[model samples]
Target: MKRDLGRGGIVVHPYRGYGSRQEVFVMGRVFRQAALGRAIPHHGVLRDVADVVRRIARHGVAGVRVEASLGANRTTATTDRDGFFDIHLPLQTPLPQGLSWHQAELQVSQGDDRMHCHAEVYIPPPETDLLVISDIDDTVMYTGVADRLRMLYRLFVQKAHQRTAFPGVAALYRALHVGADGEARRPILYVSRGPWSIYEMLEAFFQLNCIPVGPILFLREWGLSWRRPWPRRAEDHKHDLITRMLTMMEDLPCVLIGDSGQHDPEVYTRIVKEHPGRVKAIYIRRVDRRPDRERAIERLREEIAHSDCELVLAADSAAMAAHAHAKGLIAQHDLVEVHQACVDEG
Candidate 1:
C-alpha cells in the first residue's frame, strides 16, 4: 500500500487481509481528498495534534464501487455510508502450495475518478501448528488504557514511533509466529477496540517495533450519534471476531493473548468454554494488580483447568514466553532470546 498521500485525488487504503485457501476476506476505505489544504507539518506537539485531527476528520466516499480480483476469481462491493468496503471472494481453486502471501488487485471507481492499489492476503502454510489471536492495547503496548485520560492524551499527542511497546513483546510474538519446530509459520492476528481512524498509526508502530503483522481487526468509530449512542461492549466485539477467526480456520487450534486491564480475561474464558477442544492455551498479562481482579481470574483459571487449555496470568512477556516454551508452543532458544530482550529493554 502507498504511504504518502497526494492532494485532490481518490485514494483507497487497503488493509492486510487473511483467509483460508478457498476464500479471502479484505477490507478498505475510499477517501476523496480536498483540493485546497496546506501541507501539514510533521514535527513538534502541535504537528502531532494536527496529524491526529487530520486522520479522524477524513470524509469517506460513499456508494463508490470497489472491485477486487485474485487470479481468475473476481468480486465487487460498494462502499457503505462510512466509505468502507468489505470483500469476501471465493477462490476458483485452492491457492498454490509453498506461497503464503498473495497479492490482490483493488480498484475503486466513481464516475470519472479511479484509483488502484494492491492488498496483501495471507494464508497460513500447511505446516502451521496453530493460530494465535492477541489483543493490542495493554497486551502489546503501553497505552495506559485503564486510565482513559492518559490514553486519550497519548493517542493524540504521540506519533507512531514515539509509542512504546512492552519489552520482549516483539521477540515473544515472533517466536509464536514460528512455532516449536522453528518453521511452523503460524499466523498471528491482532484485535483492538480502537477505531479505524488510528489504523495507519498502529500499522506504523508494528513496523517500527518489529511486531509480526497479520490481519488487524478494529471496531468502527464510536460517539454520541443518534445511530450509535453507545459503543459496543469490548467483550462482545472481541468475542465475535475471535469466533469468526476460529470458524474460518476450523482445522487448527489457537492460543489467545490479552491483558487483564479490561475484559480480556472474561472474554477469553468464555471463548474457551464455548469452543472446548479448540483452544490450546490462554495468556493474560497482569496489567491490573487489584486483588479482586486477581481472584476473579484465578477462579476462571480453575474453571478451565479440567480442559486442555491452560490460563496463565503472566506479569510480563518473559513469563508468558517461559510458559509457552514449556507447553511446546515456542522453541527453547526463543525463550532465551525473550529473557535477554527483557533485560536489554530494561
Candidate 2:
C-alpha cells in the first residue's frame, strides 16, 4: 500500500517477515469534544472503528467509487472496542512490489466526514532480555539537596514538584523497557523509600522525564518517629517491597542499579542470597561523601559473594554500559553509554 503523504512524497507499511494469518494491530485511543472548554474525559471517549482499504490504480479506472487509500481493492475491519484497529492480511494475498515503498493508511469514515492517517511501519530490531531494577532518592532521582530536612519537607509540608530522574536516566530506562526495535517489555519495578502520598507528583515526574512507566512501590514514614501509620518498621517496609519485586521477577535475570547513599546494597545483597538466580548484576552509583558507606558496601558484597551476580560501582552511564556489555545483558551501543541518557533525549 502507498500513500501520498504530501507534495512529492509517499508512505507505506510493508508486510514482511510477519507470519501468515497473523493479526496486524495498531492500538491507541481517540478523544472527542465534550463541553466547550473542558477536556474530554479519558474514560468516556467512545471507540470508533477504522477500516483499512487497499487499492491499485490502473489507467482504466478513473474515479470508480474509490473508498480509501490505494484504490479500494480490499477492506479490513473496524477497530476494537478500545478504538484500536487491526488489519489481518493473509499470506495468500499478493503484494505490490514495484514502488520504492509500501504505504498503509488509516481510513475512518463516520457520518458524512472522512479522515485518513497514513503511516509507514517497519520491522523493529531485536531486544535484549535484561531487567533493570533501580532505587529511588539519590540514586535514580535527586532528593539529596536538603538532606533529611528537605526530605521531610517534601514528604509532609510541600509537594514534590522538583523531583526528576537523573541525567541519562530516561534514555537508559526507555531503551531497557522498549527494545531498540521498538518492542516494549515489562518495565523494571521501582522499590523506593518514597511515600505513596506523592503518587501524582512522582507520576508527573516520570512523564516529564520521559521515563518508562513501571509499578512503583513506596515506603511509609514510620521512621520519622511520628505519623507512623503502619505497624511494620521502616526498614522492614522497604525490605518487604524489595523481596516481593525480586520474587516476582525470579524467572527473569535482572540488574540492580542504585546508589551507595542508602540501604540499597544491604537490601539487594539479602535478595541476592535469598534468590540466588534472580540477580544478574549490581551497579552502585557513587554519591556524596560518606566514610562509612564503603565499609557497608564491602560487607554487603561479602554477604552476596556466593551469588553469581557481579557488583560494580559506576561513575557514569559508560561504566554501566561496560558492565552490561561484559555480562552480555545489552549491546555496547545501547543508550546506556550516553551519560544521563534520559535528559539527553529531551
Q: For model 1, how does the per-residue alpha-carbon lDDT over 1-346 read when each residue is reduced to its tens digit?
A: 5433435556678988999887899999886554324665545665565666566556778999999998778999999887889999998866678998899998888888677888989998877779999999998988998777788766656778889999999999999998888888889999877767678889999999999988888855543245764455555878888998999997689999999899888999999999999998999999999999999999999999999999999989999999999999999899999999988985
Give all candidates' CA lDDT scores.
0.85, 0.51
Q: Pick the candidate with the highest lDDT.
A: 1
What residue pairs clash in candidate 1, if any at all? Answer: none
TM agreement with the true structure for every prediction: 0.93, 0.55
Give a tens-digit lDDT track for model 2, residues 1-346: 2323222112222221111111222221121212222232323222100000011111111111112233233445553332323344332343453321234455554445455565332211123255567887777677773377776545443334456556677666665665444453534656667643344466667777777665454655232224643324476666676665445434656778888777677777877887778888888877745668787787777777777887776665556666665665554466445544634543
Question: Model 1: what TM-score?
Answer: 0.93
Q: How many backbone clashes does candidate 2 have?
A: 11
Report the Cα lDDT for candidate 2.
Answer: 0.51
Give the residue spans of candidate 1 off by over 4 A: 1-9, 33-36, 39-46, 223-232
